[model samples]
Target: MAGFRPRVPAPADITMIAHHSVTLLFDLSDGADLAHDARGRYGRGSVAVGLLPGDFRASGRAGEVLQIRLEPVAAAALLGAPADLSGEAVPLEDVWGRDAAQAEDRLRAAGTWGERFTAARDILTRRLTELTRPDTRPPVDQEVAHAWRRTLGSRGRVRVGSLADEVGWSRKRLSARFSSQLGIAPKRAARLVRFDHAAHLLAAGRTAAGVATESGYVDQPHLHRDVKEFTGLTPAAVATAPWLAIDDLAWPASPPPAPMHQRP
Candidate 1:
């Protein structure tokens, strides 16, 4: 979870790279708009952005935004739906209905960013609790969950075949189940995770060649191609991306633990 309020207006345009987690953006401004490839205009309010939305740009007046990134396992239960959000961004109202509006109202009513963050967390916690009650939905499979963790822990360098073998499932079965639950093939997820790590390294002043090797890319070109494919930007460009500049402030820690509402 992260809360952001710009002290000044936004820059010209900010290009975002694809990431491995589901993103929830709560708009707390009156005039700013969020636009993406799938949804041209995101009105003022809460918006749910799924994983791996390639190369989207956010352009409009600057404003306060509460951004939450959820792992797919927890996101599935919190969202009251399958984790098939890859390459998609939808209105929060579409997922949470009137509750979405209520949340926004509560956040708006809060006097401080701390208060707003608390309100948003409470709303999400309540929703997750309600959705997971009495078998309303199936939890993500243990094997699938393990695979996702392994991929992320390894910085996307894990071999899917080995993961499947470790989980006692065939490659085909693992791929199918992972895709069905997480909205992305296991192999593709690994690539995205790996690219995310490499992007951060590049941003931190690592040479492209070093980042490629350390991130498990075959070579610099392999890293470059993956960066381009996910972000529509070359490795050099991605190294200086403004979108990544705020990541440390927004998400300072490692991937968070599963929310209490999710099943073990």
Candidate 2:
């Protein structure tokens, strides 16, 4: 989980970028602070932002907000139907109904960030538990799960063909099934992961040339091209993104992801 509380009066750039996970956001302010991006406008309050394939710039007045990132498989289990989210910001009530409002209330009532975090965790856990009690969404495909994990584990360096081989299916079959379940092709997912990794490295103070080499790009220009494609910004600009400066600190356990934004 992460928090955003802009320091200035200027409406924060709040410019959105591509993300690899399904992000759950709780708007702590009056819900009028942030504006939406091209995919769709996120109505204030609780919403889930789906994986964005490319840049999603948005502007908004600065305010407090909390965020949670869920892996695609976990998101499938927890969110259930509409397991096929693309670049949309879906209202939580659409999925959780009135319970979504109640959960957001819990977060809003919390006196501290820790309290809010705990509240969010318990709420999600309860939802996941409820799914197992009766009629529920089918579990994620094991082959697809393995393929995704492999792609992320290898930092997107692995080929989809090898994943197909490991899963005892042809490249074409694996890609089709994966897309059906995850709403994104394996190749695209890998590209996002690789780009995310490179962006995180840049945000962590790595030079474009260094990040390119370390992130598996052929050269700095190649890295620049990908960054531009994903964020509509040069590598240097992405490196200076205010939100990215907090990514490493917020999620230190994993290879840092600039998938979230938190005003410093």
Candidate 3:
């Protein structure tokens, strides 16, 4: 398989792991630092390639990045840890759990693609070893995630407050924990989830109006504002994206020019 490789300091530091698919990465070799900011409406802030909504912005590595194909939602679900690519060295515990230090060490020690790949796989496997087989009862956050998924499927919208209430957490407490673990706010996460739903509909050749309604936008104008704000482009621009092919190896792009809609 044609997997990507990570590097420490080189232009090729950030390489595409798969064709617009799940990204796998090899960290910096030895003591070299990796730097990059993953900024977008759909991706995690900064995290390992397997993390969902994670798009590689810029990184410094001399090694290789090994990657695989993964759907957006599946990628999001695998995010049981925290990731930060804000050009700041966020503590691992602040992002992941108490085990974050160990994971970071292992990742940093990984020098080659083989080493990093093995470490990543092992870390993920061991971390989620409890869920090797599905169970009726899961951790509270996981339960909350499930609930959010259900809400999205039914009403096509999710509010952080509702989820926090269900889990008996204050909004502040829940947001703090969620941001540390997921590298984004609960409300932003919900917005991305909603955007994902709309993206899928649009990709299926659905009209903007239809997609807006189905994905819970208040109206076409509202959808237009959302599409523009999330993506730097308009819906029409995205609709004609030339790289809109399956396995097309394209990053989601900004939309076309349109009048700015003020955020209420």
**Highest TM-score, which number?**
1
RMSD, each candidate, Å?
A: 5.8, 4.1, 10.1
For residue 184, model 3's alpha carbon misses the true position, in angstroms, by 1.7
Model 3 — TM-score against the truth? 0.51
Q: Residue 28 of candidate 2: its Cα lDDT?
A: 68
Candidate 1 off by > 4 Å: 9-13, 30-44, 82-84, 134-137, 250-264
Writing each residue's lDDT as its tens digit, candidate 2 over 65-156 gives: 78788888888788863345676776667766678777777878888777778778899899888876556446678898899899999998
TM-score of 2: 0.84
Instruction: Encode model 1's per-residue lDDT on 72-147: one tens digit a residue.
Output: 8888778754465677777777776777767777877888766776777788788877777775546778899999
Using Cα atoms with residue i matched to residue i, what is each candidate's TM-score against the true structure? 0.86, 0.84, 0.51
For candidate 3, the lDDT comes to: 0.48
lDDT of 1: 0.74
How do the residues 1-264 of candidate 3 rate in per-residue lDDT, one tens digit apiece? 123332233444342211212343323334334454443322222234433333334445434323333333333444333233222222234434566556657766666546665776787667556443475333235644554455455443767777778778887887876665445566665666676567666766789999898888888887787667655567776565432322222323334212111110
Model 3 spans with C-alpha error above 4 angstroms: 1-23, 26-80, 83-123, 126-156, 246-264
